[model samples]
Target: MVSAVLLAAGQARRMGQPKQLLPLDGKPMVWQVASAACGADLLEVVAVTGAAGEDVGLALADLPLRIIHNENWSNGQASTIRLAVQSLDTRAKAVLFLLADQPLVNKALINNLVKAYRESGASLVVPRWQNQRGNPTLFDLSRWRTELLQLTGDQGARGILAAHPQCIHYVDLPGPEILLDVDTPEEYWQMQQLWQQYKVTKG
Candidate 1:
């Protein structure tokens, strides 16, 4: 089973506020990301909340998934990741990690990565657009479980990807907007614009 993990624990120091609760398409940003995870082909969907844990919880309360609050969230992304890994379902053979800030992450993208993880023998299945690696990466838990647990402060799974180039299976996406993430106010605005474009195109 491939489990979907939505990492919604960032403090958003650059945005000067909790970006998780920010509105996107009439729902919270984290909600949209988690929704995509739930819509994916994964068996289990887990969301790790931090910073504005309570508010984020309320936003995601109606979703069909489990919530994990990380008290040590302030420490960094690594702590939240570790907590997420520790709570994975025993049957999960691969874990797809999604970022809450990337509201543009849709079900199709996630499903595509999961499909890659299943078909490719590589340890990692990542999205790339014009050579730029993107979020919602799928890691073969059976292979990278130790590396993920060993992650340190502010560190993410990128370290493992960088260390083992041959083990990565890159799925090139059509455009870069599909891989965009919100960090600063300007980035959020740009993402909102992209969201509008997507809505119209898919409408």
Candidate 2:
């Protein structure tokens, strides 16, 4: 069975606050990401939190997910990833690595990745948009647990995936949403406007 790990332990030093708590479409940003994960056809979902763990926890209180606190979160994002990887239940054969900041990624995107994982048998599955890889990657547990624990720097899992490109499978998505990440106030504001436009079109 496949599982999911939502990474939300960053200090958000650039944004000056926890971006996970940043509001988007009437709820915390991380809540939207977590909600999407909950909608996936997976065996388990765990949200790894640090820094402002309690506040983020409250934001995701209603989601059906296991909240795992990363005490070594100050070390970096990789530390939180290690914590989550270690917390997986025995039933999880693989894990989808998700980022809390990518609120635009929906359940359909995650389900698409899961479907690809079950079909490809690749050691790592990463989403690609216009030929660029994106977040919410999936790693086959049997292949990368050792390398995952050894990850220490700020860059999350890219180095390992790069070193083993033969094992990495990419899912081609249609939009730039896969490349958009809310790191600055301007970007966040732009996303809000875009979301408003999308809503109007749907309405």
Candidate 3:
């Protein structure tokens, strides 16, 4: 089974608000990402919440998500990632880690990453659109679960990917807008502008 674990616990210190709760196309940003992940019809989709845990959970409550609350959210990104990895089903052969801020992530992009991992058997399946590399990266559980669980503070398995280039596979992402991560107020505004353009094209 291949599962998706979304990291939604960020403090968004720059944005001065929970980016997960930020509205995108009338729904919370996290909801958009979660919906896409679930819609991909993968084995499972888990959302790890920190910061505004209850609010985030409530926002995603209607969706079919396995929500996990990270008490050590203040620790940094790695904390939530490790927590999510711990909560995965033992049967999961691969896990995709998604950025909560990437609301542009859609079912098609997610399925592409998962499908590539399944057929390519790459240790890591990353998305690339032109020159941009984006998130919702997939990792073969057998290859990186140990290292993932070993992540400390804000550390992630990207270091391992950097160390071993031979095992990484790059899948062509259908859209470059999926690379937008709303870390600042300016980016959020940019996302809002891009959203309009993206939907019209998507439709």
Using TM-score as the measure, which candidate wins? Answer: 1
Better of 1 and 2 by TM-score: 1
Report the lDDT tens digits of candidate 3 across residue range 1-203.
Answer: 79999898988899999989989889998999999998995899999999999999999999988999999999988888889888998889999998889988899888888888878878899998986766878888887888888888775667777788788799986667788899999999999998888899889
lDDT of 1 by residue, 1-203 (tens): 89998998888999999998889889988999998888889989999998999999899999999999999998889988899999999999999999999988899999889888878887899999988988888899889999899998897788998899888899999988888888899999998898899889878
Q: Superposing all C-alpha atoms, what RMSD in Å does each candidate have to the true structure?
A: 0.8, 1.3, 1.2
Instruction: Give Cα distance to truth, residue 57, candidate 3, Å.
Output: 0.4
Tens digit of lDDT per residue, candidate 2, span 119-202?
998889998887787888899989888889889968889898889988888899877754578888887888788667756754
lDDT of each: 0.90, 0.87, 0.88
Residue runs of model 2 more than 4 Å from their true location after superposition: 200-203
* Runs with alpha carbons beyond 4 Å of true place in candidate 3: none
Error of 1 at 153 (Å): 0.6
Top candidate by lDDT: 1
Determine the backbone clash count of candidate 1. Answer: 0
Query: Which regions in candidate 1 have their CA more than 4 angstroms from the true location?
Result: none
Prediction 2 TM-score vs. true: 0.95
